[model samples]
Target: MPSFHNGAVEIAYLDEGEGDPIVLVHGFASSKNVNWVYPAWVSELKKDGRRVIALDNRGHGDSVKLYDASQYDIAMMANDVLALLDHLDLERADVMGYSLGSRMTAVLALSQPRRLRSAILGGIGIGMIEGGGPGENVAAALEAPSLEAVTDPVGRTFRAFADQTRSDRRALAACLRGSRRLMTADEAAGIAVPVLIAVGTADEIAGSAQALGKIIPGSEVLDIPHRDHMRAVGDKVYKAGVLDFLSRQD
Candidate 1:
């Protein structure tokens, strides 16, 4: 694991394989290893001959933890990705993100389109515009004394995940509270780069993949049949679609 300073925050990341670069960003309460590596994403992508880079967002995994809710704004988190690209001297590369990371990917695609060859948004759909995910209830769940104290279904799921990961619950609470901004339809429509939006057919967390696709001009959508938000991460269909999407770019 290597790290670099994005201002005061230390971001831990893994850079593996060789060839054209593709950065991976994990979801909320999840780290690079859990979200990408354990799911065989790095291995599969490497097998496809890509330079894979994944990072621990600030306040998650091995990255510097911050307790201030104001520090976890979506743009701030997105900037970390930009900083990572700058650190690696990559002027532009394919970028992929899951769940919360999807939001960051969209921000980069919209605000800094020139920095991305393409964008892959997994575990996210119209929620990018309609706005839904871990809300204050999830934040409250993170602040709860224990998972048993979290009764909200969604909250409990995230709390249990945080416990399983042995993450900084307090820091996650702030991140959940701060990184709740949603993009407007105009913003989503503004994205000009090649975009691939993949969501499970059974995913309740991500809205409609087709709906989002319709919003982003020329964007492609891939549906992971019968998979939900969590299970969709490593689905074969999702992997194949991504590889195909990447291949088309070359």
Candidate 2:
């Protein structure tokens, strides 16, 4: 895993193939391999002659772990993406993210749209963008003494997944604490780049893709029928939608 320094923190990333660049950001507790490679996103994009660049956000995967809660701010993590682009000498590139990654993408779109040609926000919904999420619960769950100590269902599920992945639980708790920031309606309306908001029909965490689309002017929604949050990442509908969207950008 290739890595770079953003100040003192090291961010792990993978760059592959060639052509236009697409920087991929994975969801919380997921690494580049699990979110991008296992889903075959790299292969699919490569087939389309795209250069796939994906990074494990700080505190996840092979990136430097931070125990400080403030180190996990969404904006801080988003800047890591920008730093990677700088390291690679990319002036700008299409950016794609899922779940927590989607929120970070929105931060970039709001604070650093100059660094993006387009934005793809997956497994995210209007609710998360507006002001609601399981951040507090999830954070507490990550730090709980045991799985039995995690009472929230959402928190419990995430805790189990983190355990399964053998992730740094303390670091994840800090990430959740620092990354609960929300994007206001004004911020969403102000995004100037082409945007795609995608989610599965059965994804409870993602409030409504259609609702989110209505907020971003000219944005499009890709609905994967019958797929849930965990099942939507690698769905054929999602891959096709992304490919079609990228194709039209040329």
Candidate 3:
């Protein structure tokens, strides 16, 4: 739970193992422990002789919380990732993210390609760049007075999960507000780095992984059949694909 300063925000991070570094960014309302530790991602990668670094993005986990919508921009959050790298003195590292984290990964790839050795984007697909994902509903749900008041199924589900995780609802709502910016196909295509798009075949929220893969040069898609957005996060197939991909890079 070591912390660093990304401007005014305090980012909490975990650094473990030793070798080529791999930075793990968690999804919305999830901390480094929930997204990577309890899921055994840190141990799994460490077993392969790789260093693992995970961080709590602003407004999530033990990091500084901000209610201002403008403070939660994905680009700014991406810079938080970069600043962590700088803090650790790493010039480049392989980065992996899920859901909202994937959007931040996209921003990282687009703005700081030189800081990444490779990128893995999970729980996201073409929908991220197509201008519609569950941000508004999820935000409203988070800000709702009660979970029972959230009528949208997707929103209710996310709200329940956020409650379960004990996340900061107001900060999360701000995160959702600032995270609506989407990347165009041309923007995604402009990234020059090894990329992996991992999504579940049954995930309606993820859109088409193949479509996104086709746009990013040297990108590959790993589809976990029979898994949806919630179920796919720690799926064995997804983990194996990611491990294999990382192994190939070494």
Candidate 4:
């Protein structure tokens, strides 16, 4: 694991393999290892001869923990990715993100399109515009004294995940509260880079992949059949579609 500072925040990351670069961003309460490495995403992409880079967002994983809600704005998180690219002295690369990371990737694609060769948004869909995923309830769950104290179904799910990940609950709570901003439909429509929006057919958290695809001009959608939000991350169908999408870009 290597790290660099995005201003005062230290971001921990892993860089592996070679050839064209592709950065991976993980979801809420997830570190790069748990979200990408454990799922074999790093290995799979590396096997395809890509330089795979993944980071722990501020307040998650081995990155510096920040308890301030104001510090976790989506743009601020997105800038960390930009900072990583700058640190590596690379001009542009493919960027892929899941769940919360998808939101960050969308911000980059819209605000910094020139920095992305392509964008792969997994575990996210129309929610990018419609604005619904983990909410204050999930934040409250992170703040709760214990996982058993959380009664909200969705909240409990996230709380349990945070515990399982051994993440700093307070820092994650602040991140959840601050990173709730959503992109406008106009913003989504403004993305010009090659984009692939992949969501599980059974993912209630991701909204609709087709709806988002229609909003982003020339964007493609991939449906991971019968998989739910959590189960869909490592699905074979999702990996195949992403690889196919990347191949077409080249």
* Each model's backbone clash number: 0, 0, 0, 0
Q: Show pairs that collide, candidate 3.
A: none
For each candidate, what TM-score against the reference? 0.99, 0.97, 0.98, 0.99
Alpha carbon lDDT at 68, candidate 1: 98
Which residue pairs overlap in candidate 1's backbone? none
lDDT (tens digit, per residue) of candidate 4 on 1-250? 8999999999999999998999999999999999999999999999999999999999999999999999999999999999999999989999999999999999999999889999999999998889777899999999999988999999999999999999999999999999999999999999999999999999999999999999999999999999999999999999999999998885
- For model 1, residues 1-250, the per-residue Cα lDDT tens digits are 8999999999999999999899999999999999999999999999999999999999999999999999999999999999999999999999999999999999999999899999999999999899887798999999998888889999998899999999999999999888999999999999999999999999998899999999999999999999988899999999999999999995
| Residue 135, model 3: Cα distance from true site in angstroms | 2.6
**Model 3 clash number:** 0
Highest lDDT: give the candidate number.
1
- Against the reference, the lDDT scores of all candidates come to 0.95, 0.91, 0.91, 0.95
Instruction: List candidate 3 stretches off by more than 4 Å.
Output: none
- Residue-level lDDT for 72 in candidate 1: 99
Shift in Å, residue 62, candidate 4: 0.4
Steric clash pairs (candidate 4): none
Candidate 1 error regions (>4 Å) = none
Instruction: Please report how far candidate 1 places residue 117 from its true position, in Å.
Output: 0.4
